[model samples]
Target: MLEVYIDGATLGENGKSAASFVAKNKQVCLEGYTFIGEKTNHEAEFHALYFALVTLKHDYSDEILSIRSDSKIVVDTIEKAYTKNPAFLSYYNKIAELITHFPHVFIKWISDKDNKRADTLARTGLQTESTVIQSCS
Candidate 1:
């Protein structure tokens, strides 16, 4: 099983958003953050998961994936099969699509204390001057 933890941080003063993720027990895995330009905190949360999923799908297509996120909004929305905000529909749909590629995918909400690594990576991503245009894995 592939275990992934994801998080997103937004610099409210500059309107910059960044996302990060960590894959546990993978020798060569995508575990970093990238500047995603301007986005709301909610959007960034979705982006974090989206980027991680895209990075893992091609290589771990048949593997069981367990994704954890600190954002309750993202986790609840995905798990409940509904979104209250129309602005997030595209992101929501994209996540749903990517989930289909995995033989088994489980998304769960975790406490911030448990997601420290990803949270730190996300904050560090906001401090970087450059944006990553491609997958770093």
Candidate 2:
């Protein structure tokens, strides 16, 4: 089984942004990243999931996939408990489309304290354009 946790950060409009994914198996960890430029925080959040899903596409399947995010909008929207504004429907759809490729997935909301690794990577991405967040194993 593979357990993956993802997080994203946005510095400001037109500012640096990044998404980080940490995949853990027992004592091992694998991380991934992408530098997102000039996007909102919400966009960054969704991008984090997108990057993780794409990176794991080759290895993801019926196995349990768990995701954690600080964005209530993304979490609630994905759970179908709330309807997002029509203006952002495209964003929602993009995430939904990516989800179709996963057999079993779980998303949860975690406070900033529990999501430090991702936060660090996000901040790091904002500070350096050439730096790529490393995947920990």
Candidate 3:
């Protein structure tokens, strides 16, 4: 099984929003974060989930995957199979599409204390000097 942790953060303004993910297995660990122009904290959280799904889908297509996030909206929206907010519909749809490509995917809600690594990476992503998005894994 492959395990992934994701989180997002916003600094002061629209430009500071960022998303991050850490994916790991017994053999290797891959983690990264990227600046996401202007977006709300919820949108940034979705972006983090999106990045992790996209990054792992190709390589773990046939494996069971588990993803953890500190955002309740992101986790509950997926786990409950509904979203009342129109602003989140697009992200919900994209996540649904991505899940189809994998054999199995689980989205779980986790405490902030348990998600420190992704949170730190997301904050670090905001400190980048470049306006252009940057990512490292």
Clashing residue pairs in candidate 3, if any? none
Model 1 compared with the native: what TM-score?
0.89
Order the candidate numbers by lDDT, best to worst. Answer: 1, 3, 2
Q: What overall lDDT, based on C-alpha atoms, would model 3 receive against the true structure? A: 0.83
Clash number for each model = 0, 3, 0
lDDT for residue 13 in candidate 2, whole number 0-100 = 61
**Per-prediction RMSD in angstroms?**
2.7, 2.5, 2.8
Off by over 4 Å in 3: 13-15, 129-137
- Give one digit per residue, the lDDT tens place, for model 3 in 23-120: 77786577878888788899999989888788777776786779999999999999997899998899989989999998888989999999998998
Report the lDDT of model 3 for residue 46.
93
lDDT of 1 by residue, 1-137 (tens): 88899998997844899988887655545576888999999888999999888878888788888999999999899899799798788999999999999988889999999999889888888999344423335
| lDDT of all predictions | 0.84, 0.72, 0.83
Which is the leading candidate under lDDT?
A: 1
Model 2 off-target regions past 4 Å? 81-83, 130-135
Error of 3 at 49 (Å): 0.3
Model 1 clash count equals: 0
